[model samples]
Target: MKLLGIDLGSREVKVVVMENQEVSQQFKVSTMSFYRDYCNFTGKIVVDLKKLGVEDADIKISTGYGKNNTDLEEFETINELKAHVYGVFYQTELKNFVLLDVGGQDVKVVRVEKGLITDLELNEKCAASCGRYLENMAEVLEVPLTELAEYSQDPVELNSTCAVFSESELIGQIAEGAKLERLCAGVNYSMYKRLDPLLTKFKGKRLVISGGVAQNKAIRDYLKQDYEEVISLAEPQFNGAIGCCYYGQLTGEAENRE
Candidate 1:
């Protein structure tokens, strides 16, 4: 059986398909383009699976930022937190760990014990702690995001608490002739600083990071100071969508058993 999962993220839409409980295909599209080209408004925005190019799934599940608010036709909606947790469970097969999912617009830190969620913290109010901050910093530096994520030592000090102001501060550092590596490290470290407070209470030996920021090596390096093990998902960005697919497969199997 084919299971389809769609994660309607703030910046992009992630799509994943699982065939016989294994990932068969995965891709992402800009949210704007996805809504414009692959969806039609029938009083409410309705996703056209044909236009999405994956219409042959036996089951479909939806998650992410728009899951709660967007009413999708011919799809079942799941909470973003639940989907993320399930995705980690499926990918890592670990029952106890701290899950940190930093998205384009927000951050989610969940504490899972014995495969169940015990506590979770969210940082939806600040862009400084999210993936968008790193994107903007990379843009200001005229560097690729991947390159920007490679620096983790001797970071320059960026004191701004706001995401917008931090960009201006980064430009000032450039004018001061700061080393490129230091500037990059500064941006990455600044993000870690913002995340530190949210993570202070969730004490765990292992941390499973998901979402776009999981690819940031510099931030991951900083995170190593707090946890003994910091593991990144193989498909970090597609985790939510993958979780939806896994959830569908699990539920489908249970129904068949019954």
Candidate 2:
């Protein structure tokens, strides 16, 4: 069986296709570009599977921020949280864990037990804790994000109360003769501080992290101090869409038995 999963995020759209339960093709496009170039005159999105070079699939599933905007009736829509849960479980095989996804503009924490979602917490109103914050801080520090990561362990205190004002505060610290390394470290630590509140309420030994920010080793290392293990999927950025495909496969099997 062939399955196509689409995760329509705010900034990007991730596509993953599985042929007979194996990942055959995975690709993505900028969300704005996809809409501008792919949407037709009638306001319908025309995804070009041939352009992605994947054969037609038996099933297609959609999830994430922009899922509801698609006009396709054939696509099955799944909740983002459910997709995250299945994605993490499919990759790690851990039934009980806390999943923390720090995306470009959102933070999601989900508690999973025995393959079921038990409770969840989400932060969308704040941009300070998300990936965008890191990007902005990197720009302020005039350092590559990768280079700035090296300073995470430095003892630097950053104002974490507000996302916008934090930029000015960083500049002020520089004027006060703070080492650039310390300033960079401060940014990384501040990101961690903002995340602490969102994470402290949930207790779990295993932490499965997803989304773009999952690749930050410093952030992951900081989080590791509190968890038994901090794990990330091989395809962290594509976790949600991968989970959508995995869920589609499971649902197909269930239907076949009935």
Candidate 1 versus truth, CA RMSD in Å, comes to: 1.1
Query: In each prediction, how many residue pairs overlap at the backbone (N, C-alpha, C within less than 3 A)?
Result: 0, 0
Give the 10-residue window scoring lowest on summed lDDT in candidate 1.
64-73
Tell me the lDDT of candidate 1. 0.92
* TM-scores for all predictions: 0.97, 0.93
Q: List the residue pairs that clash in candidate 1.
A: none
The true-versus-predicted C-alpha distance at residue 29 of model 2, in Å, is 1.2
Off by over 4 Å in 1: 67-69
lDDT of 2 at 32: 85
Q: Candidate 2 lDDT, tens digit per residue, 84-195?
A: 8888877887899999998878899999888888888899898999888988988888888888777666746776589899998898898899998788778878888889
Task: Please name the candidate that would achieve the greatest TM-score relative to the true structure.
Answer: 1
Q: Candidate 2 clashing pairs?
A: none
Q: lDDT for each of the candidates?
A: 0.92, 0.83
RMSD, one per candidate, in order: 1.1, 1.8
Q: Judging by lDDT against the true structure, name the best candidate.
A: 1
